[model samples]
Target: MANLDLTLKDMMAVDGAVGAAVVDYDSGMALGHLGGSKALDLQVAAAGNTEVVRAKIRTMEQLRIKEDIEDILISLSTQYHVIRPVSGRKGKGLFLYLALDRGRANLALARHRLRDIEENIEV
Candidate 1:
């Protein structure tokens, strides 16, 4: 299994990856982060996305949808923000967030790779 550092490094290898972070949605805190420029602060993004995840979970509960979320994709004009909640036993309440350049990223492949990274993460 990969540790947090290795997992984040792997995420950077994805095409068009601008930044990546592992966050705890419960506390809205990032456990680790890599990449990101002055304009894209990974820490702030992680906290903001925690609200997104919590809202979605509340909605699902209210609607009685028992399925788990695969990933949450927020596509912008220039960027794609992918929020993937880690499903492993050790990773409950944690998520992996990746930001990609919309024009250069292959969304499908990035999702697939993120899944792989999630599975292998040791947390």
Candidate 2:
């Protein structure tokens, strides 16, 4: 299984990846991050997205939807943000976040790869 550093490296290899991070949604803090520029701060993104994840889960609970979230996608004019909560036993409360350049990314493939990475990661 890949460690945190390897997981982040694999994420950056995606065609249009501009930034990636492993975050703890419970605490709104990043465990590790890679590839963000001044325009995109990984730490801030991690904290903001924690709220997104929490809100979605909370809403799901209130609606009585028992299924777990597979992933959350945020599409912007220039970028695509993918938030995937890790499903492994060791990864509870953690998530992988990836930002991609819209013009260069293949969203479907990126999602598929992210899923693979998530499954194999060892936290």
lDDT of 2 at 14: 96
Per residue, candidate 1 scores C-alpha lDDT tens digits across 3-122 of 999999999999999999999999999999999999999999999999999999999999999998999999999999999999889899999999999999999999999999999999
The true-versus-predicted C-alpha distance at residue 29 of model 2, in Å, is 0.6
In terms of lDDT, the poorest run of 10 residues in model 2 is: 85-94
Superposed model 2: Cα runs more than 4 Å off: none
Clash-forming residue pairs, model 1: none
Model 2: lDDT of residue 95: 95
Candidate 1 TM-score versus the reference: 0.98
The residue ranges of model 1 lying beyond 4 angstroms of the native Cα positions read none
TM-score of each: 0.98, 0.98
